[model samples]
Target: MWTIGLGFVAVLVIYFTYWLNKWSNPRCNGVLPPGSMGLPLIGETLQLIVPSYSLDLHPFIKKRAQRYGPIFRTSVAGRPIVISVDPEFNHYIVKQEGKLVELWYMDSFSSLFSMEGESRTTALGVIHKYVRSIILDHFGTEPLKEKLLPQIEVFVSKTLETWSTQSSVEVKHAASIMVFDFSTKSIMFSYDAEKSPMKLSEKLINVAGGFMSFPLNIPGFAYHKSLKDQKEALTMLRKIVKEKMNSPGKHEDMLDQAINNMNKEKFLSEDFLIRWVFGISFATFEAISTALSLALKLIADNPAVLQELTAERKAILKARKNRNSILTWEEYKSMTFTLQVINEVFRIANVSPGLLPKALKDVKFKGYTIPSGWTIMIANSVLQLNSNTYKDPLAFNPWRWKDLDPSVLSKNFMPFGGGIRQCAGAEYTKTFMAIFVHVLVTKYRWTRLKGGNIARSPLLGFTDGLHIRITKKSS
Candidate 1:
């Protein structure tokens, strides 16, 4: 009994010493940033996730930012994170990617979207460049001018025509379907109302929702479900890719382009190709859908904004004498006010909450030390919502963007992010939005139904399906 008691005492003492060392203030020059790490194992994971799950980076961040300045420490997604809201510092971090910091996501994210040998981490330098080049070539402005915009116009026209018949429609849900259809069709030439595209989108979305979930394999848990669905989605995509490769059919889509462009010697395998296809499709679909839904809802609530948007669209329609004329790239660039409204939507939505970059080594900034291996979250939401940057940051003011210099705006307004890994499909997203807005405002008027709110759930979107009633516009 005495021997056992001594052993237990020694274990407790060792653990106490370790805990003290782990949480202790630095022995080096700079101090750790101010904030709590919450409970031992869980840390502030719950505190971070609750508001995030509700689609707001509130109380946890806002409250802490108030108490601990722009930089603070918290634990989330099963790792210790340094949340930096300092705009300049955040910009510096992104600019210095691959040197000072490496992009990191939760384990579940890494697992679910694992691209074999060609992941963001594994596929660095030439491999990343190759994949990005392929994506850009397929989805870039030139491609949009040649192939995509006409299809988008058709999709939007058909969707609005359907919406006009219904007494009321859930705009977000409908918009999600529309974007998914466009994305799947563009990527894989697979889209149907009751078939593959719909199923694939739902499964991929479920996988995305569980990207930050705990890596537990319990049957009912989100992570388990994500892995399960991911395998299923992968199986479906692999079969499609195999069939496409085998078929000599000359399809003028992204899949065909990728297969033709692929060089196996460069280590770009069928596995990498399929992963890239589905990953890009799923990501762009959600982003476009979320942004469109929110933009429409915002325009509906703000009559003045809607009126201005309508005027902009009407002018374009008048210029093209035929009502059914396709939107031109020149016209997309000409909708300055419409672009401002979309920018404001991006700002307020903070659609992409924070850009994650892990510190490669111990780094000091703004009189604080961030330890090596710590995850640095460049909180874009904080910058967007900061009172210092905008006159009335919370207010949905599109007009503020009218006279702002492009250079000045780019520094602060990074909805698509900045640096080497900046969103490749930004132009694609912009074109989609411009065309959708032009078509909808010209053809139909919409009013938001009661009791719907935008929720974050880690992904910015409407909670109760942005319900709206639509009616055809009188010519």
Candidate 2:
């Protein structure tokens, strides 16, 4: 009986594999791009992601691009996708967002972030406009100057003051904690009631890490555990929402802002509010923290760059009246070298690796056909690393941008993305990082120690925490 059962399972596997391969490709007039769709159900997924786990430059795609040209076909996460490394085509696809394509996310991503249909990617038409407007009002330029900068300066200064006493700190963990605390305060007007701030931050980090996992619900799988964590996180947020509604007189945070403006006639529920807050918080939380960690690591690795960045920060500080004065928006904007360093780190880190959008209809581009419902992966990381765009793509050189024209950089550089679906929190994330960097470079210096590695399990970040030692600089 056991032998028969095993044989039957094997037969079923073979049948499914055969069916998936035939279904993935159908004869077309314009022809699809050249590449192999490895195996049937799996379809090159493992081959593509395994090398990327250590944050390597997508060996699977790069090797094929060398053989098959820039635009190629492959399957990932059980869906057939056209991976475009062509810079011009990518820019076109992203800019033509609503007309030619619509934003798409993986099942694991939507589930892990607890943003089923609430995120800008999933929301469409009036819903998308409304969500984007609210987010901008909360974290846009005006709010960053008036509200966020002062708060971030205080929190970052207080946090780093304690760090200077420690012998060595895990930079990634430390950064994650700081960003999460600040974000929670901005969103909910307080920290966690159920868990410690650090603990909650770590939980959110895990959830974010698993957002692009392979959507398996089996026990012991990372995605499964992340789903469980997502539920717990939402539950905590819901409790906070209830408490705020019950006892709040006047609060000045995203939570209050949202509550005050919610449509009572439409009867938007607490669940809706919780999802909105969670959507913004979860997406930006890890990216901002990872950006800081990577920035620290990169600057530490490059001494000349560090010296330049420190000098810039010092000039900004000297313009202030006193040591205790908070950095003004003008001061932050004036740090040109510091801005270059940040942009360089963004390019090297490739934090937002790729943008996934689904073909709204059978779209044709460059004599190639993308079927309706197929996934279009704008490989932004790949495009950034293209030899045609940057001088030496892999090198961490901030000076490359020194003489480069801003118009040219804007055309090729897409750290946030392009078009209508671009990240709403891009400027907000940058402001948070700028504030953190201004405080650190002005008051202290850090050295990245050994045993730090980049992790790309789902997205770009550090693994085992980028360890560093911090010390105060002499004035």
Name the top lDDT candidate.
1
User: Per-residue CA lDDT of candidate 1, range 1-475, in tens?
Assistant: 9999999999999998788567543343467788777666667766655534343456677789989988988776447888988887887888877666777632213333435556455544455466567677778878888878888888889888999898888766677667877777767774453665437777777777676566677999988999998888888888888988887355467788777765443545677667776677677877787788888877877899988988888788788878677887788889999888888888888777688888767778878888877888888887777666777887888998877677766667888888887888898898888888888888888887764576664457655677788889887
Which pairs of residues clash in candidate 1, taking residues 3 or more apart in a chain or in different chains?
55-456
Estimate TM-scores for all models: 0.87, 0.86
Candidate 2 structure quality by residue, lDDT tens digits, 208-240: 756767767788888888988888888878877
Instruction: Name the regions of candidate 2 deviating beyond 4 angstroms.
Output: 1-20, 24-30, 52-56, 105-123, 190-199, 212-214, 242-251, 264-271, 455-458
lDDT for position 213 in model 1: 64
Evaluate model 2: give its lDDT: 0.74
Model 1 TM-score on a 0 to 1 scale: 0.87
Model 1 bad stretches (over 4 Å): 2-32, 52-57, 105-123, 190-198, 211-217, 247-251, 367-369
Report the alpha-carbon TM-score of model 2 versus the true structure. 0.86
lDDT of each: 0.75, 0.74
